[model samples]
Target: MSGGVDSSVAALLLKRAGYDVVGVFMRNWTEPDAAGRCSAEEDFADVRRVAEAIGIPYYAVNLEAAYREKVFAYFLEEYRRGRTPNPDVMCNREIKFGDFIEEALKLGADFVAMGHYARVRREGGRVLLLRGVDAAKDQSYFLHQLSQAQLSRALFPIGALTKAEVRRIAREAGLATADKKDSTGICFIGERDFRQFLKTFLPAQPGEIVNVDDGRVLGRHEGLMYYTHGQRHGLGIGGGFGPGPWFVAEKDLVHNRLYVAAGRDHPALFATALLAEDVRWIAGAPPDRVFRATAKFRYRQPDRPVEVEVLDERRAFVRFEAPERAITPGQSVVFYDGEICLGGGVIDRVRRPYFEARRSAFGDVFDRVLL
Candidate 1:
């Protein structure tokens, strides 16, 4: 349940709907806090108490081994290659919808449920994923990896309710997590001081921060892995009494360098076409031709108009009608047609006119390593 207000209310809603419910707290990882870091033991305790109050059997299932191989390992690999990884999306795919669902089935439960704000439905004998009614908190992007089988057996009771309504439901039900703050960062991984977390796994590879327009050194960074796309602060480059702030333009993984510029007006961050791989469709098949839809590159971004064309079974190309900034490789690009989630994949490349010119200049190596 993650000891969150949403999940607790979801369980209560399911219980009232006459479903035989069992509260499960999946233990994905137990991070040893560094000298001054804090743990979330109390959060687990709170989840346990809520389970007791609901009179449902609760159990902690350890998924650490699977999490390491499937989620954490991928996360490390992505960063090592200078790409931002979404661990939550991988966790939902590999551990939650995969292993956790298997465990639930073994326990003879008819459905496995979670706090995700999304909907599931069956149409023409196939399961379809839908966006949550609460657009502000819709989590279908993270859930894009779920198969039709998983969708059929999953329950998202809070899908139709807003966050405010969820809190009210929890309070009226006398749930302990009624007023609990939303858990941030990676679940079970605790609140990460991100730079500190990277230092633990990736060795300090000090590099220069250069200007994208001119290859002039501006500052230095421990490693490119510590930074992400669209970051404006902590560049270590002092733009004292300037008219504007600097934003990260690029991270050269091979040369171990970062590029920054002191303006947000640059077109470098904007993308017209995004190429995605590691494709997973709810129906296990790709649609033919270009399909008009709406897509969101990140979880919080509003889904905007796009055209998705399947390049192959394993790859698809998404072209935004207008440029979307910071279309980072390794992040997801989830497609939706109305409320139904068409599915999504990992962003492998951004197709821009300038990028094409650079690719032509550098040849195949540029295409292979830019991601």
Candidate 2:
């Protein structure tokens, strides 16, 4: 259980169905806050209260060592390489469904359960991962890296319930987390300053912020890791303001410099195609030839039509029908056929034919910029 209303209600629903429900709170990451406090302790207490109230056997397991080695190490490596990686996907794979399931089975669990807002379908001995009934709250995007084996042993008890309905059920059950605010950002450091938290691990290296169009130096940034592609806010830039404030257009990680564009619709922010590596298809390998499908480059983005070609079992080349903005590397690009999620892989590179030439001659040539 996450000490949240979702997990608590999941356990309750299973209990009502006459199944042997056991609440397991897996303490995965224990990164200390700036105040030296670990928030996992607070969550543990909440889980205990809900598990007791529901009259089910509750237990806690410390998976800190495993999480640090498996999930956290990968998270830091991605940032070091100037790529944004989603640690939640790694946590779900290596820790939750991986280690947690092994732990749960040792405790005699028939099936592992989570509060994820996604569903699983079994037909003709083929298991399919489907979007939850609550489209607004559908989390199949995050779980897109899951394998067939993981989905086979997994259960999402609250996939059919809307967020409002889940909250109402919690209130009716008098759960402690009925009104608990939804957690956002990384679980280890909740609501803390993102850049400041990242600096704790990734050393801050000062870099120049260059305007992408004119190649003019705007200002200095604390570190490239603190900024992301196409981000408009948090940049302390001044002057040269034409269309609006500057946005992060790219990161010259090799030179330790950041690139900015003046307008939101700047061409520097869009890409025609992207390359992804480590593709894992839940159903199995997709057809080797080029195929049309829908994909989401980021979690909040809507699925858009794309042409996908399976370069290999672990990689693919994707061309979006429409130009995609802020296609950052190291983020997962999940594929889908209608409501059925077909796994995904981490983005490796974005192909920009127009920018590729300009990016090479950026620093020296100023007047040649288009906009």
Candidate 3:
């Protein structure tokens, strides 16, 4: 349980169904915040209260070491390479379903259940992952990397219910977490400034912020790690430049420079195709030689039509039917056929719409080209 209304209601529903429900809270991060407060302790306290109110036994398992080695190490490495990585996707794959499943089985459990907003179906001797009933809260995008084996042993008790329905169930049961606010953003960086938290691990290196269109230096950036593509707010580029604001277009790691475009619809922010590596297909193999499917470049993004070509077992080339803005590298591109989440991979590269124009204008600015 996550000490939230959804998980609390999930446990209550399972118990009401006459199943032997045991609440297991995984303590993933234990580091204290800047105020020297441990959020996990407060969350676990809520978990205990909910478990006692529901009359089910509960236990807390420490998985901090495994999380650090498996999920967090990759998160830091991706930032070091100037790529924005999704640690939640990796945490679900590596820690939650991977290590947490093993820990559950050791406790004599047949199935491991979570409060994920997704569903699983068994058909034709195959396990299929499906989007939750709540369209606005569907989380199948984050669970796209799950395997057949993981889905087979997993259960999502609250997948069929909406967020309001979940809170209602919790309130009816008199659960303590019925009115608890849902957690947002990265779990490790709770209530703290993201750039400040990141700087605790990765030292900030100041660099020049360059305007990609005219090759003019606009300002100095704190660090390339603190910015992301399509980010407009923190560019530090004030007025008098043009009639508009600026957005981060690209990161020139080799030159230690950050590139920005003047407008939101700048060509530098859009891409036509992307190359993904370390791909995984839920069906355990690739599909046809070339096939049309829908994919999400990021979580909660509407699925877009794409023609996927399998380059190898671990790589695929995806071309979007239309240009997509900020098709970032190091993020996962999840594929889907209707409600079925096929699988996903880490975005290794992108083919920008203004590649030729930037090359001609900036010459060797992007030596390590993302084109």
Candidate 4:
């Protein structure tokens, strides 16, 4: 329980079902926030209270070292390479299901449960990952990388319920975290400014912010790492050029340049194809060498029709039926067949129409083609 209503309700539901539930809070980040306040300690306190109220034993297991080596290192490395990485995805795979499961098994636990808004089903001697009943809060995208073994030992008690129902259950049970606000953004970063928080690890390397359309130098950027594809608000590119606001269209790591587009719907902000590497299929292999399915480029994004071709074991090429906005690199592109989450992979490259048109002029600098 992360001192939240969702997990408290999950534990409550499991206990009510006559399952022996033990609350194990994995302490991943030990460092205090900018205000010198330790959020983990506060969260654990809530966890302890809820465990007591639910009549179950609870323990806090420190996984800081494992998280830093496995998840945090990869997060910084991706940003250093000018790609925005989703650390939460790695956190779920490496820390939550990976290390946390091992720890739970050591305690003679048969299955490890989490508060994630996702589900699993056993069919034909195979474990299948499924999206939660709450379409708006479905987190199967984050858990897509999990393997069959992990899914087999995983239980999501509240996957069939909506967020409102979760809060209602917690309140009715008199749980301490019934009204607690759900945590958002990167877990370690908390409510702090993302750009400022990233700066603590990656020092700002001031670079030029150039408009992709006209090549006009708009403003100075602190660093390409501070921006992401399709971001608009923080560009600081004041009005004068056009009626539309400036949006980050791409990052040129070779030149240390941040590329911007004038409008939100600019072609530079959309992509029809992408190449993903380090692919992990939950079923241990792709359904076929080529198949059609629905995919999500990021969490909370509505599913889109796509055609996927498995080039090899660790890579796949994806073609979207319609243009996808801000198909950012380093983000997981989760694939699904109906309710079944097939798997996902890290977005390695994208094919944008605006960039393709200028590829001849820019030479290899704009070449992100995978075909």
Q: Model 3 RMSD to the real structure?
A: 1.2
> Considering lDDT, where higher is better, how would the candidates rank from best to worst?
4, 3, 2, 1
Candidate 1 global Cα RMSD: 2.2
Per-residue lDDT over 12-73 for candidate 4, one digit per residue giving the tens place of the 0 to 100 score: 99999999999999898868887888889999999999999999999989999999999999
lDDT of 3 by residue, 254-288 (tens): 77899998889989899999899889888787668
Off by over 4 Å in 2: 357-360, 363-371
Candidate 3 has its poorest 10 consecutive residues by lDDT at 362-371
Q: Which TM-score value belongs to model 3?
A: 0.97
Model 4 scores worst on lDDT over the 10 consecutive residues at 362-371
Question: What lDDT score goes with residue 37 in model 3?
Answer: 86
- Give candidate 1's error at residue 70 in angstroms: 1.0
Which stretches of candidate 3 lie above 4 Å from their native place?
A: 363-369
Give per-residue CA lDDT, model 2, range 1-371, as digits (tens).
98988898899899989999999998887777777778788888999999889899899999989998998899899999888889988888889989999999999998998998999999877778899889888888888888888888999999989989999999999999899988788877765777888888989999898877877777899898888888888888865556667888878776788988878888888888988888888887674468888998988688899999998879898998988888888789999999899888998888765577675576533222111
Clashing pairs for predicted structure model 1, backbone only: none
- Local distance difference test, each candidate: 0.81, 0.85, 0.89, 0.90
Stretches of candidate 1 off by over 4 Å are 35-40, 240-244, 357-365, 369-371
Model 1, residue 112: what's the lDDT? 89
- Per-residue CA lDDT of model 1 for 243-284, tens digit only, reads 447787667776787876567866656668878999888777
